[model samples]
Target: MPAKSEAQQMAAGAALAAKRGEKKVSELEGASKQMYESMDEKELEKMASTSQKDKPTHNRKS
Candidate 1:
């Protein structure tokens, strides 16, 4: 998914790093860590809803 903000971009990068074993989730620091930790399920759902609205559709014909 395309990240909509700096925090989202950083979080995505961190998740990718963790998945590749380059870093542990516990190793996250600074804004990335704070943002990740601060999100609850409800907040996550709200973010997802807003992000979905911001996403572009790919079904258009040339």
Candidate 2:
């Protein structure tokens, strides 16, 4: 049996990474589409805030 060439191994690894990245992008797109379709402006705006921002004013300092 022959060993695999370096170029072949690199190509295979790159192809696998590309496939995984594409899957992640597709999932995010689906989520964004669902959110846009289902959420009202107020709800979406509320969701945009960080937890820190949601705390009372006195709880945070500059």
Candidate 3:
């Protein structure tokens, strides 16, 4: 599924990089760290690939 916000998309990209060994997993923090641990490469890829054009910086809880 696509990410709900820009931050989520960015986190997914960070997590994806770690998963691919382009970045160290230890370097991830916050949502990026959690996603690196819980999501597979494919899942992270999907979320990370989402366009940020219309997404908000943060998704507000309603």
Looking at model 1, the pairs that clash are none
- What TM-score fits each model? 0.42, 0.35, 0.96
Tens-digit per-residue lDDT, 1-62, candidate 2: 11133332233333333344532423333434454455554444444332433334332235
lDDT of 3 by residue, 5-59 (tens): 9999999999999999999988999999999999999999999999999899999
TM-score of 3: 0.96
Which residue pairs collide, candidate 2? none
Off by over 4 Å in 1: 29-62
Enumerate clash totals for all models, in the order shown.
0, 0, 0
lDDT of 3: 0.97
Relative to the true structure, how large is the alpha-carbon lDDT of every model?
A: 0.53, 0.37, 0.97
Candidate 3: residue pairs that collide: none
Q: What is the Cα-based lDDT of residue 24 in candidate 3?
A: 91
Please name the candidate that would achieve the greatest TM-score relative to the true structure. 3
- The model with the greatest lDDT is 3
Tell me the alpha-carbon RMSD of every candidate.
Answer: 9.4, 20.9, 0.6
